[model samples]
Target: MAKKKKKTVAEDDLSAEDLGVVPEEKKKKTTAKKKTSKKKTTTKKKTTKKSSKKSDFIQSSCNVGLVGHVDHGKTTLVKALSGTWTEKYADEINRGITIKLGYAEAAVMQCPKCNRVIAEALANLLRKSKKDPKGHCPDCGEKLAFKRRISFVDAPGHEILMATMLSGASLMDGAVLLVAANEDCPQPQTREHLAALEIAKIENIIIVQNKVDSVGKERAIEHYNQIKSFVKGTIAENAPIIPTSAIFQANVDKISELIEEIIPSPDFEDLNEEDFLFNVARSFDINRPGISIDDLAGGVMGGSIISGQISVGDQVEIRPGLKNPDSGKYKPVITTVKSIYEGKHSLETARPGGLIAIGTELDPSNTRTDQLIGNVVGTPETLPEVKNTVEIETHLLEKVLGAEEDISVKPIAKNELIMIVVGTSLSAGVVSKIGKHNSVSLQLKRPICALGGSIVALSRRIHNRFRLIGYGYLAE
Candidate 1:
């Protein structure tokens, strides 16, 4: 009976094979994905590949000036971005107002998933699960894109520093106008700065409603509406108003995004080919009193390049240089640039549209105390001609700005000496001739380094201060 059962089982197995039912293998097999070492090795290789690709990023390409009323926190906003407070002087810190043009630089990075400058809190929330320092947000699982760096020019908002603000305007590709959320929409300097921007033709602007932490959301919205009405029919009529708390850094990421969107780097084919034109605003003697002659550094000139490019070791000339006592002619100063500095970053070459400080091989005496201020620097024999007599087409405004007295603008009369600001160059000019409407010529007291088609700001001493009356372009 046992032999008969065994024979039957064997017959059944043979019959199943004949029916194409295959037997399964019982040996255990391991997958490469489950091997811990192999998985870690793959991840490490991917991370290294991403790290190598992130080294290329664009630095700052243009300068953005900060403008607003005094004590409105323009410098504070700069600090929030750069982590460096721009108020370097003791008086500025004590007085709680920016006295001069303050500069600071910051890089704005964008999120790879959303392509936005994520608010710090939001970014933290999104990246909570990611262990990689510069890796993607865990929520979106995308990396961060490093955008360009930006330089901020924090200009004084005091009524008296209108000329300095105007000069700073010349250096800006666009401007960020700050309006305090705790105060009224248009302060005196706020109005004046907007007017100055109009005169300077800086059309690209972003209005920041600052100090949001000091006000409720309702109050902030009221200020926002007020700002809209204030800028109605103005150059900033179409500009975006971003609400932020510069002190607490609320919505500061939006400021970076707005800047990138509004003021892009201007495209100019002649960035490297044209003759360089640098308007000197500030100069310094970096030497200490105890420094020896061998250790004394060359003089440094600070300002922005208006056009073209300059390089270290380039032979340059300063227009309206020291007057030659014997020849009675102003001989342009000939010097070589020992180094170039933008903010704290040193560079071998500098292009137009950012604050630049040139270290020149000249006596510290010439550049000390801003002695070389109001001068123009450029390649030798390539600078615009120095003009003591300039022909201008005047365009006077309808009303005087920032004046306690509500006075209508008076026409520029013959022999009327007025303050003229061309680029960063300041001069006093007498109206030598007046033709038809908006047509007038001036004989300047201090010569200006100017070319045809240069725009000049005209200021008259209204009461006690030089108020911007109008602007005109030089006749070619």
Candidate 2:
């Protein structure tokens, strides 16, 4: 065999065509393609990393619920302040009562006497290099900012629908207790709702003496004083009592002002994130696909964020039956938020004082009406447990069962089934312990929904009557 001549450095690095395999340009092109492939792989990794960071920065928002007496202008006031019709349902409109939870947005408008319209107009013209701009009294021109968003859940106030009212009230951060100026004293529902608020431990309240336009200033003042005296030791004791007229829009600005003063911004951090829970006031199927369609068709989770925040794409865990199912084990189903809407506006995140509609991937059949709804989307380590025992501090409404002595001596064992409402979540649990301190521990027959540390109401079933007796908190 002839000895192969030693190839030079350039000769050894042969192109594809060196051996008549292909064109030299094609070989170069192939090599370039390989390099580009590598670049693309590197670029793809970078893009994924960037996308994740963006997702991490997006936080959740809040929710609020409206509670008060029927015909107290709760619906009208909601329509006026939120600029949305809460009672859109035919049944609700026809009955002139909020049978179900009616959701609306609370629109924030600037104080006509405080906004700087002229300055804003001048700034706009300056940017456009235009002068002699048409001007108006800045002090009188109130504008709505897109950023300042609020929501409300108009709850029913019918005497028979106290459960519904309590359900709605449980999900609120603060409450706007509407009392008509025309009434000499608080209605039964008014006192009931106030009691419910106290049970839920809702600390922020703005007492609105609605229909003030119907009453002259002198009478309105008297009405205000009466209400002031009524709420003296309660949450509304120090609450601003603004006289308002939704029909005439008189003192309407005052409602907005009070809301601004009372409703804390959504940006504020909740000190109680670990125990954050949202109660579902209403669940409906939508005619929409995927998770949203499934969620809507299955069930639209409606409630207020009692604490913490919830965002789209969050993985939530549903504890059905509050108690262990037939298997004596709590059933937990995990799902993601397909979509989130506040009133009608689609949102990426929701805070603690607005209404939230969560389209979930859960099968409606599996998730019962009053199951405990919570997000397993955050730190699982911090997620609350589906506890059987809950500690409570309760208040008994006089018309119903009178006192602790009224608790049935027989057939009603401690830890027996009793209805409880916290936020919008409602379910029946067994009374685990009744303390001498007027507190009780409920070993919920089912895992009634709740956030630890959240205030919950207890109503025991005695014969044919449902008695609102006490309030409690979820403990470890």
Candidate 3:
């Protein structure tokens, strides 16, 4: 097949793309992006009953991460797997790098004809629209069966956004590590991200040897060897490596198949509802400009539930939530869950798995511009208490990562400042005391709400930018 006549679908006003869809035309020296109008979710007046019924079904999706070095095709792979690109910020779009944590949801569909699970490439973002109608197999015109929806958490690969990536990893159930065949294996972020995944304790990983379209056969094979060598004896040592040209939507079905086979959804039913927790990664005021107060919707909280379940009308608390500007003190915000959404579909109940949004009864101003991000949401009276300081058990790696040169990790010194990340929350703290058992007490600059025994990612400022030094857990 020739590439010259192919037409790649643009991000806006689209549902999904299929193998039946064409790839974007490419130039040897440049990559092209087509921007469409702002996304809207209004369904046609002639909407069918089946579509409405499909929309009403309640199903939770698991998270799958797209992580690796910058310019290595993580976003492109997301575009291939899910028709919409994840980068929405003007800076991210203009710079061609994911600066914030970008997310897009794609459903894994199985072809009835071949029984092959494949990419859900035709649907537009569930985040942007309320509809996620299924698509047909590109192989056969026969309709495809819906397997499961997996949220693609597109972590920023730039060294500066390492903290952002770590926060996003807290939501992921599994991840696909993207490595471009055109570059050397284990680029700085490639190594750092792998370490972060290890710290996050994510064991399910798939290596995507991307850009085979740009590299020759010999070069591609050599890069494969490099990837294998890089992951040897690491958490991803047994992970499968899938070669693909995400730019051309090649071998995406194989990636989808593995996501279904290897990355099963969390056993939500087995999780005790008594241990309820939600990690807030984003917050928003969905009201448009010029909307009257009576017509304005309540504020929204976006994240994944870590355990148990939540529902409409349930009373919940947002901890370390709103800050009192005058006194600079933080307190929990208790509110009712007015609505729950997985993508565009409104749900009566939200469980642990993929990304979701909880519509609360608070003023839209409170949630505007992610004011409530990095906070925890849970049962009102049972929520963890907000803390201004904490003690943690530590685990340090021998060498520092994300640096140009290898350097030994230095011991934590008293009074030194460090960044600590836990379940989408990030805080800077001063080391107040160092215990004999690799533990340190920290006086936090910003208050945080997390359960005991939660994983903590520790980073030290290096050359004015923080680099991950090690990880630890909150004391029980």
Candidate 4:
């Protein structure tokens, strides 16, 4: 009868105790693993939230300027990025020199899973003839429905076009310095541009050593070394030099990545809707009455708003001249945004970093180039004084001046004049004082704004025309 007793299900299945396994210990280990995994999941969620907030602040909006020596593929690189020809003029393409400052618009997106920044995808999406209204992340397979508007200014690089280049760079937050990889070193214009950038106080620069396909790896490396030597002790000394071929579309993706890293995002919180500043580069009257259009608007002055909001009837100010005519002079002009255009479409209100055209009581013809226009416009802060004493950091061209020599010590007598170009304004000034330290001072023949830390160009006043002499940095 005892042998016939039925075995329990737990005993038939081999209980932990019978198998010499410790049930209490096994249960404790399993519980520990569950708790650890739960903590890990919670930590990961918190990290993701923090990362999202940072991204929102850093990628709100961005602006990049294209600069370098002539024929260094500035326009080509821009076209490659946006897939739209920025320089459409036949003469400009044929002459191999950008005649004027050009502009184009695009958007940037980010990945969901990997959270990587993406460019050119928006340009590609916009290129489609059909309204593909949706976007996806290139890195992760997740959907990227958000968009950030971006603006690109294509600046000319020729020495003769220095004024145009300065105008373009003055408005940009970042610069793309394109150096041809085939050339042994940057040309004279390249040096001139570097000086101009220094004068503008532009700190962020991305160097693109283009034309790598033509030169191949060996020569490209050689040219790259030359670039390194050329940029020594300059703001661009440690700038990332990306070797690319715009014609071949090689390393084109890297351009966007570099831009995303260098350019700072617009500060949306401190921005104002009506407080706008639009520098007038090109202005003309339209067929419509009481309305004018600025083809190439200069520096846009307004607070950044990332939430996609702007409205019409916003009051703005317009400053007609570059150097302040009066110490505290501002011409307040009220205008409503007659139309807002983003990339070729019209919108009632434009998000930040998008091109906007406003219709106002101010005549476009009256708005001259180099003028600043904005809402709540006040006299621009007085630029550094143009004095008789000039302190400069200079580089001599053609062995005419020595780097270590104080050329100004043998003072040019009174009425000795030289050319000065800062930002978009160019004028002549006479040597007023020459100090013991390679420092020389000039009292501008015509009153012009010469800010401290500005780069000043010295030219021989021959035939009453300014001839290229040398370059110097303004000092306190």
- Global CA lDDT of candidate 1, please? 0.76
Better of 2 and 4 by TM-score: 2
lDDT ranking, best first: 3, 1, 2, 4
Off by over 4 Å in 1: 1-59, 118-143, 323-330
- Which is superior by lDDT, 1 or 2? 1
Off by over 4 Å in 2: 1-64, 111-113, 116-147, 213-222, 270-277, 288-299, 306-312, 321-330, 349-353, 364-382, 388-417, 430-445, 449-452, 461-465
lDDT (Cα atoms) of all candidates against the true structure: 0.76, 0.59, 0.81, 0.55
Q: How close is every model to the real structure, measured as TM-score?
A: 0.81, 0.68, 0.86, 0.62
What tens-digit string does per-residue lDDT give for candidate 4 at 341-413? 3344434454445333333344433433313321222223312333434555554444322122223323345
Better of 3 and 4 by TM-score: 3
Clashes in each model (backbone N, CA, C under 3 Å)?
1, 32, 8, 13
Best by lDDT: 3
Better model by TM-score, 1 or 2? 1
lDDT measured at residue 246 in model 4 versus the true structure, 0 to 100: 80
> Which ten contiguous residues of candidate 4 have the minimum total lDDT?
11-20
Angstrom error of the Cα, residue 38, model 1: value is: 42
